[model samples]
Target: MTSALLEQSVVETPSSFRVLTGDRPTGRLHLGHYFGTLHNRIRLQRLGVEVMLIIADYQVLTDRDLAERLPEHVEDLVLDYLAAGFDPGRGTVFAHSAVPALNQLLLPFLSLVSTAELSRNPTVKDEIAHSRQAAVSGLMFTYPAHQAADILFCKANLVPVGQDQLPHLELTRTIARRFNDRYGKVFPEPAPMLSAAPLLLGTDGTKMSKSRGNAISLSATADETARLIKGAKTDVERHITYEPQRRPEVSSLVLLASLCQDRDPHEVAEEIGSGGAAALKRTVTSAVNEFLAPIRARRTELARDRRYLRQVLRVGNARANEIADSTLAEVRRAMRTVY
Candidate 1:
């Protein structure tokens, strides 16, 4: 299907719909991220939706012990977005730290949510476990609130997310409803714009994650990507087939190839079936490298113009601040804090 068709199939919204989607700038984005959300974001922007891409730097602090590496991470993230076809002119791409209004809005939003409710957020619980934290810090425990603030600050009506993120979007809705009922209707109850894309697993046949070393970073060199795919674990079955339950390893490879080729996984499986595991690996490696070649080249070219990258973020920050200031003013007015 074409990108427009893919977008229309997943997103059912009006032409004036506004969307807010982002990533925590902890590291480079990967294929899992590309098929999972980035592609959808680009498609939505192309369709004339008001898209805001946030570099959630503060959210990274929930688990990261050091803030020193954040600048590098943030810059790399902007590069990935540019390479992935996210146009700053078409959509706002700003850092969370630069928008002080979001932080200001977070304080009042915290009161709208109860501690018991925060404790019940499954996404937060899952993140804490994944981070392997001995104990959840206050900031980490209350991250859902931060996320709620992120959504409401923009008055965003649509948030593109995967199945795992449904609970977080629900929390944002809950906060929006409670605040509107208690104070006034100041924010939209953001709905989840679920992607139709299949979840891409890591090369290790597990959930793709940067920390797990199973992920394929979009910024990885062609040789590095080939090496990773060659080393990827596959089933011992002689025939390549897509059987996710019985053969998750091989199915993950099929899934990767399908997404890269934009065809059905079964079709990819059939094409590579005759070659067995070795052939499947070679096909997957070639397909992935071919798909990433242009993206990587664009990223390399963009990385050289550091001045332009800085300007993009600066302009995005100013645009975000302008919208945020207007939203915060309305929120303050609703709460009788207009002074």
Candidate 2:
């Protein structure tokens, strides 16, 4: 996607912003990671912006029944991120639980945000649909507030979000405004850096989620990638067209191809002209495999040395603590919680 396209999609603001964004380490990242946020985040760090990546481990409890695999989940996600070129030294990347101060900030933050506001968040509603006991779990109910602390605790001034997450960001901004009003101006109202990447769907054309089995894990073998793409659904018609409304399956393939090859999907469809859905799938699988080759190699190489991966997290957590502690101190003073 061109800068012009992104600019046209979203209004530009002043640069020199501190950024915060992340994911729940429920499992390994997938193709969705590359197109959705990973590539853009790396670019943002290189642009000299201060960046903080949160591994939202605690947030996973909202939907998950057992938290026994938290450590392994975090480890896998960190490795995948490293393989995908997220430099830990250039920016801090740490688990949410690693920084105690972040959770501490939630106490005062909750006082400013209301139950009505939390209930209105779309993410809470969307996630609940996936949970068997969606009606239960206070942790699930209050996730948005915890997310508010995730950004506010680091004093992050900017948050990159998809449109689906705008409601969560709105809650974060609401918390900041309420806190500053009740206490003092201690937190910056975080602004949204809306993503240009569209929501990349899974093989079955549903949202790409681990539970859905439609995701392509970033660490999967080339053969595994080829197998997944080969079986992916396409329209029954032999001819290819880019009309998502009419030919959703074909259009989805084109979108995935465009993301992988960084070329226009419409152009790709044109090049494959009348070759039929089989030809289109072959082209998409090949392009996807070619794109994932280096990432797979990097993942294989990094998986060999587990010690370095642990060290990466250790160092990143310590750096993240420093930032979190500073922000918490200011928050405490603003709320007069200081001894």
Candidate 3:
């Protein structure tokens, strides 16, 4: 799918389109993120497409009352993006707090979506259901509108997203179309550029997440990775097969190994046949450690220079503001709001 998308005339003309993607700096990104998104972002960047990444520091407050150690988490997100081969020279990564124009777009975009639509958003409902607080914030309820602002602020026409985030993007598209029909065409109806990479299961055979304590962070030490893999759940399947439905746990390890080694999952499974869980884990450990070695090294070097990281933020925020300001002006003109 990605190959097809990349080969399309529109994508070949990278200047014609821009991609908006982001992460909430709530915790460290994990293996699930690398396969699902980070790698795809890098691939797109290399293809000459313009990318804007938002470190959504504000949205972090929707569910939680406070964003603990907010600055540190924001820096870590940029670090992860850099270590994963996202070229800062070619892409933009900005903090939500730093870009006032971006947040200002939220108010107008909010009026474009209905409360009913917001309430039924599966992602929002799931999040609200799982929220730590007994009472929810209005920000949490209007999360999709905020996301629309994030995407539309730059007039970004493409968004790299997983299947789960499709609803949010669809709502954004709806808002864009509505705004254009109601006022004027100030935004593109964004499309989802889904990742071609297969979904990666966590070490525990369940959905990987940082809060769940089952994720293997990109920043994890080799020893930490090994230990985490060592404790992964697997059944008593000596002759390993890549039957995901039947042997998800063992196959997950084999999948990780295959990903690290850049080979087919089944091929990896066949090679490790009869190796059992222990042998499978060893394979994963070796492949993962070796693959992540360079990235970890880069992260180490980058993390040591806090000033450079801050500079990166400053550059990204400035770019975002420039784009957002232009879009807001256009929107104001469309709405006849200028005095």
Candidate 4:
């Protein structure tokens, strides 16, 4: 969908939109996730858009045996989501395994796409390269189809994704269009609500990731946040600047401060002129900690109540199943398999 069209839909028909967005329980979410998609999700849900969050527990197995202490990881993810102001009362947050009907949609979706197409998917190719797998797991290979089921089973029409994830969503759109052509119209072609923020680089001048040990987690304490920022990559140049293309590492730090301060990156750099990387790091540390303080407090408070967290998931799973069941019934009827 065009940017203009998406804007119109968000403003004019938010109630008509259902957004599918989630995280893998592989690790804790970080700044990349917060600015990348989580912030937009909270906005849409508050705007009355139906949001369905999948704590994709199954997807973790696609690359690894399983997430260690998997349930703890899932709860951590939910904590991060709630701490970031994602209201489960206004939307649904469920684990991927809980909704059997949703997984069932994978069968029909797989038939609509080819192995060659899945093989060519950039995201899948990247994962395979990093997974160090001698032979790809079937689940890993067919992840695109599984994701399509996640989106289409709830008939989600708006998917909040990073730019790198467009290929996966494009495949989902293709499956929806093909299903409509071959079986009948049973799904909406979901659109990408790309994050406005540029991708946040990690502290070590790489992609921000929990496994990489370069990320600042939402649950991180003030001291940990300070220590992580102290090790962030920066250039030797004394003058601070925000020229991303020419000085990415230094500029990334500047951008981090800007995001936390909610100011222009260039402006943030100007204020730190000649103070260099040390000054930048201190500023970033302060801004990050100050911004995340309340979020961490909420996270800590919420963590004590495991029962409330469980109840949230239980409610979300039941609601997600209802939608999944209804959508699957439509799929069967469209395929003349209701008998």
* Model 2, span 89-146: residue lDDT tens: 8887888888998899888877877788878789888778768663659998899999
For residue 182, give model 3's deviation from the true position in Å. Answer: 1.0
Best by TM-score: 4
Q: Order the candidates by lDDT, highest first — what do you get?
A: 4, 3, 1, 2
TM-score of each: 0.95, 0.94, 0.97, 0.98
Candidate 3 Cα outliers beyond 4 Å, as residue runs: 1-7
lDDT of 4: 0.90
lDDT of 3 by residue, 75-114 (tens): 9999999988998899999998998888888888888777
Candidate 2 residue 336 Cα shift, in angstroms, is 1.6
Q: How accurate is candidate 3 locally (lDDT)?
A: 0.88
Instruction: Give candidate 1's total backbone clashes.
Output: 0
lDDT of 4 by residue, 87-171 (tens): 9889999999999999999888888898899999998999999884567799999999999999989989998876788999999
Q: Model 1: C-alpha RMSD to truth?
A: 2.9
Ranking by TM-score: 4, 3, 1, 2
Clash count for each candidate, listed in order shown: 0, 0, 0, 0
Give candidate 2's total backbone clashes. 0
Q: lDDT tens digits, residues 1-339, model 1?
A: 444653564466546578898999988999999988998889888878888999999988787666658889899999999999999998889999999998898888899888988888998787788774566778888899999988889889888877888888898899999999999778888767767767677888888998789999999998898889888888767999999889989999888888888889999998887799889888888889999999999999999998888899999999999999998898889889976
Clashing pairs in 2: none
Error of 4 at 266 (Å): 0.5
For every candidate in turn, the CA RMSD to the true structure comes to 2.9, 2.8, 1.5, 1.1
